[model samples]
Target: MNTLNLADGYKVDHRNQYPEGTELVYSNWTPRKSRIPGVDKVTFFGLQYFIKKYLQEDFDRNFFNKPKQEVVAEYRRRINAYLGPDAITFEHVEALHDLGYLPVEIKALPEGTRVPLRTAMFTIKNTLPQFFWVTNFLETILSCVIWMPCTSATISLEYRKILNQYAIETGGDMEFVPFQGHDFSFRGMAGLEAAMMSGAGHLLNFTGTDTIPAIDFLEEYYNADATKEMIGASVPATEHSVMCMGTELDEIETFKRLINETYPTGIVSIVSDTWDFWKVITEYVPQLKEQILVRDGKVVIRPDSGDPIKIICGDPEAEVGTPEYKGAVECLYETFGGTISETGYKLLDQHIGLIYGDSITLERCQQICENLKQKGFASTNVVFGIGSFTYQYVTRDTFGFAMKATYGEVNGQGREIFKDPKTDDGTKKSARGLLGIYKDANGNLEMKDRADYETEAGGELKTVYKDGQLLVEMSLAEIRDLQAQEVAMDLTQEESI
Candidate 1:
């Protein structure tokens, strides 16, 4: 791992080897439109993390020089393994080794700002015209870094808006909204990096997370110190395996021990659907009510399987009087009767709550909030564990993210280039010419094409990366502030509508 070879890192054919007179290829990536309508703005994030993690290290010449021959041999060996011994024709990657650094410049919107669809978050191009191929060569890494974090940020913002609306209508404390949508996706993401990156995005709006690497990621790249700042955190929680160790016959004892002996002074979550979810709610909870009520902490009940909406907020159509009829909230209400607030919202007893972590979608979140309101319950009575279903089940095309070279220079001439494939409809048509992002009359981020960077005084994009150095760094607090501004704007607009 000490010697780095990128021969198979990208599509071998995409090495930018040939395209007549195409000494440079310029491209721009935009989320043409959201797959989910009304998702018009996306949160710009993860650029700092990606640049610090992937681009600023092990990639350039100085680092590669230490193991120069080994790096060259690996590249040659891998390429030859794929294309045959003599098909290797690119000077054994020595050109890159001798060059000693990447020749690239990157500009981007500050992390945490809201960008309108089709606006570029960041643009990359080769600083040395001869290394123009490096622009697209970096795409393999850029796409992986950009799309997922942005997508996760966008999704978390949408959740924030939903929770904010519910907080307003249900008289729940808005200050507590950030911790409502917790991250439980560490075990479910594509990899550790994926979890860390997406989890960082989640922390932009909330401080609750189970992804531990995210805290480390924020500390490393975003100037966040857990000892000094309230970074992502979570409480002790149990899974089926931990509960099943004592057997289902002793399940009630497990709950008693969790409340009385373990984690008695802070929030602790216990998954309650191991053998029988309804029995735990109707039978087991009553047995532990004294311990739960006097523990001076919260006990959050987790329902791992079942339709989340019906499980959290009861099915109005189900048989009304049977033990099988009541849901978690209703059952909890029966055991410890709660008082309604002035806004007519049911405030669950301080010691008990509900959480549903499985198969939660945006629509499910909306429905759950609305259903709880209809039942005179505050939306804050429950917390949501947004799992990989929200973070992992996405792709670049989820928002039509595509990076294409729009302008390049060659032979002392600058050319504006774009792709308008007529073979299909217009989803693939890209922007033409050099681009600039500026705020318009309404202070919304907008894109301008065929623009000069030096004279564009109104442009908001700034140089963040040049050559091998990261020129601009962002802290998590700065990102959170940007997101808060955008959320305030969105809420204002929503009220007018």
Candidate 2:
């Protein structure tokens, strides 16, 4: 059930077989931009777990456990088939593995910090005297480990910002903002690791997730044991399969059973749109009002299809009674007759609520919240299910993330390496020499190039990975605290603006 089981299987076999005499390949990776104008920072996360799980455990268990001769023979067989004959040597790999540890060091900005664009988040250095190619050799695995969690964390943080803004404006309970944007991306992720990593990223901002693997990942890697602290949770909710099992004609009966028979207490969600969504909301809901009202829990009606903004906030121009009828949130408000909050926004009745789970984007989320605010309704009446479109629909290039060697040593000499392609614009230019990150006086992130790692003093960048051992550890609670601090900083900046 480990997320790295498959990737660890074959990743040790992937290595470049050229450019002999390479004694070192030092690299530093950064998010140059977020592919959005005026967006200049990313939440740094999950690198330590990557290093521990894949670099240490996976390689040690799969590749290092093999006999040296057998490992060398396999590498030769595989590499020679691709490159002529004797393109490279596996002696260094065997030697390092035989030494029982990875001769590499990774210095990184503390996980959960809001790292600035074009600033180096991590610097990779090969500590082995002769194995200069080791650091670059691990680029395949390192890049794979770095990008997704950071991207997902950044995206989830953006969602948190939007929800927090609306909560502040509409007088919704600020504490509820953490659960306002739930993670519904498990079934939509690329694979198990993608689901767990991205889901863990979502947990950086919220406490609501349906991704089971994420909880395990947090407990295994981030010190978030469910028995100790609140990592993430979700209410008992029905999918289309469960609703369809009762057949469309008996859909109302299915709802009745879900409320009365299966879960009569706490919170429960039923996919109301399995047959006729509006009919369930406008007709059957009122008919079952007695049962729903008397129950000790809230019934969250889910609308899975149609334009989310219009479906949740009501269509201004569309005719009533049509399939594109007035949305679920507005309908719930009409039937329940809610009280107004101190901010003059309508708060739905405690017994009923709404959640939209289909094709939700950050832009659409803003529109839905704004529409509700304009209609005198608090954003708390509804929750948004952030899925793959917000998590998996991204790549390393989404933030221009790349790991390039900037400093290296060869033949008793120290070299500062860099690349600035003449064929392209300045976006490809990379940093030179050793790098370090520090927080400025105003609590903003700043970067600096150092003569060497030893010369750096009291910087925010810490030694996270060294000699196949993890040096720093973070917990889910600590990460949430950092995010809360970032939110406070953002609020302060907005006030200044």
Clashes of each: 6, 2
What lDDT would each prediction earn against the true structure?
0.81, 0.82
Off by over 4 Å in 2: 1-24, 320-325, 450-458
379-440, model 2: which lDDT tens digit per residue?
99888999998898999988999888887666656678888999977788888877767777
Q: How do the predictions measure up, each by TM-score?
A: 0.93, 0.93
Residue lDDT tens for model 1, 1-497:
42233323445545445454556666665787788757888888888887877776647433455566777666668767877886645652566667877778888888898888878887888787666677877776677678888899999999998998898888787877888999988898999889988998889998888888999989999999999889887888999999999799999999988888888798899999998999899899988888888888889999999889988888778899754456678789889777776688987888998888898888899999998898888898889999899989888888888778888776657788877889957888878778888887999878888887563334777888888789999888889999988888888998999
